[model samples]
Target: MTKPDNPNKTRFGFETRMIHAGAAPEPVTGARQTPIYQNTSYVFHDADHAASLFNLQSFGFIYSRLANPTVAVLEERLASLENGRGATCCASGHAAQILTFFAFMEPGDEFVASNKLYGGSLTQFGKTFKKFDWHAHLVDTDDLAAVRAAITPKCKALFVESLANPGGVVSDLEPLAEIAHQAGLVFIVDNTLATPYLCQPFDWGADLIVHSTTKFLSGNGTSMGGAVIDSGTFDWGQNDKFGGLTAPEPAYHGLTFYETFGDLAFTTLSHMVGLRDLGATMAPMNAFQTLLGIETLSLRMERHCANAQDVAEFLAGHELVAWVSYAGLESDPYHGRAQKYLGGRAGSVFTFGVNGVTGGYEMGMRVVESCELFSHLANVGDARSLILHPASTIHRQLTDEQRDTAGAGPDVVRLSIGLETLDDLLADLDQALHRAAAEGDKAAE
Candidate 1:
């Protein structure tokens, strides 16, 4: 296959790049859309070519389990968008996290991470990772002093979410990156909430970026996929701590990744070893759907941000609302950090608390259930508005103290604003609020 011209030479802006980067007319039929290569294996030129491909001396797809043409296009596009050297696709965001750990961590090793992260991630780190004998120290990532203090000699990486989920807290990536570098550790960021459209973590000094493409990248609530993009900036050769990449490998015939692949060491090793062993590779069909969704990412994100601002403003003045926690609002505690990092667009998700009369959590649940325009669902980043009462649903797994730490209190409701008309969304909220109030009043009486 012929390589496309350099994306940098085109001087394309983000929207144009989203639609065109890493995409070209189909070689087979001149088709405009990206065609999914559904075959399980590719043919070799001959026995010598097959031998070379299997030995990793030459680049060629041997099996869909290792790589697929459809998935490769998506990976290249995402890498270009994120300004990373390369990327690896996975079945889900959790799978991407596991692959990252498998590549860099070992038994008895620890990593320092932010306290404010998605609840699912918190559980994964605090619980699931223990099975591997790896540990995590959760610290306030915003406080550089605390982060520095938490980093032990055993720490191999610094993990943070660009914009934390549910809580909407934004980490100071530049400072965090500096800390990681000074400590001789890799820096990993979960960019699922912010998306590349809002913030590219690599620009702020992250070494490895992870995303759940099932969300904003796939824009319309279709397909479950994830990605890990290597910035190709981290010097594995400089650090003796990361022996996984710098040391000789047994699986690849004593080959050292840093010596062989240089900047692409992390990404290549992630695919060649992590994916091969873990079996978390993404399907070609899912990658195709995500690619289609990403093409319109810039446009969808604009609408989502605008709608969220409208809803946040409306909620702030409502008598039924006790508090609103949207970073777009000046009243929010994280407003300053959000302004500094979020490019003036405080994403589409925020949490608001309803004033409890006598019904308490029931009143909040009623408000969520009564919304006609917003679907009550666990997912976000849909074209349609979505609402969730976490205390009774997503955060139910946490204890009261844990729920508070996760920012999912009983009266709080999380909203993912959609492309629906602002007026219609307001009307739905108005009706829901009234219904909730009436139910609360009845309970009080």
Candidate 2:
């Protein structure tokens, strides 16, 4: 039987694509939603067909460890939303990072990444990646000179968060992309914070985009998934550094991915090699949940940003607040970059320092514990508002200097604004601030 052509082949707006892209009524059951293909393995038509699937000559699922129908829809939808040629979905955002670098780096390879990133990412690059003999040079990406100086011959890529988590620091993407291309390094952006609804990193010359779809893309805190999308513009054959793509693969009967797959080489290699070996495939049920979440991404993001702006502004003026670092505010250092890259929406997740009589750590904890409206949790991008004290929780492994630089300092409280009534959010925060202050005063006495 011949494959049926996609009805959604025509280009559409992001909002439309979010709902309709990569999906058609189930061929057999006429289901409108992408149904979960929960089985572990697929039977091939014949030995010839099985050989083709195993050899990567055809794109079909052989095992759940590599691909699934439900996850494929999520990958396609993400690729459409990001305006990229292809995407690969995995178990979580961290898995997405591992898959992306696995495609490029061999042993003894190096990469440069922005120092300001999710605390987990910093630890992954600086610590876990070292286990693979892959070294990372963490640098202040804001300083172009420093970034240039950090890139040596062994460096394979440059990584940065499009909007640094918790810090509200918006990266200057265009110049950073230029710098990466000049140094012949692949540019990778973690777009978890600034979802495609707010900023499309591919629009600014990014070669690759990664997302912890567990966050904004999933939106409701119900699913865990990650994705890596390829722009399909990088020239793997330009140099032999990326042997995984350009060189022959002994496992697949001397298949040269770049020569055979062309624009899809990296994405194909990611599935055939990365997912096949690493086994970080996303579950079909999780993909279905995420697809449902993504359907209303634009709507949720607009409300999230608006609520965050109001909350940030309210905190900026609160007597017990030391500082707020949301780029939506004009006084923020990265306000200009936010305007250029994120359409002036500085995302909903940001940090503010709590002013305390003794120390920020104590006051910050009090404020978090005092909030009634916001749920105190480690996760973000929920339909409900969430809060965290990063220094004690997410950034606990980092040293004092590291936490401060990443904007997850002792006094910092990170807020993930949700679709709550603006007045209620304000009142809740206001009460929390005063309550914390009162408690701090009693402690002093």
lDDT of 1 by residue, 1-445 (tens): 1113223223567777787777888887999998989889999999999988877789889888788888988988888888788899999999999999889788999999887787778888888999999999988787899999999999999999988878888888988998999999999999998898888787778889999998999878889999999988788877778899988999778988999998889888988888888989999999999999999898899999999999999999999998888888988888887777788788998898888777458878989988998999998888889999988987786778777877787888999999999999999998999998888888788
Worst lDDT run of 10 residues, candidate 2, spans 1-10
lDDT of 2 by residue, 204-271 (tens): 87899999999988998999999999988888888767888998899988989999999899889898
In model 2, residue pairs whose N, Cα or C atoms come closer than 3 Å (at least 3 residues apart or on different chains), thus clashing, are: none
Candidate 1, residue 347: how far the Cα is off, in Å: 0.5
Candidate 2 lDDT (Cα, whole model)?
Answer: 0.91
Task: Report lDDT (Cα) of residue 421, candidate 1.
Answer: 93
| TM-score against truth, every candidate | 0.96, 0.97
Task: Choose the strongest candidate by TM-score.
Answer: 2
Clash tally, candidates in order: 0, 0
The list of candidate 2 runs beyond 4 A from truth reads 1-10
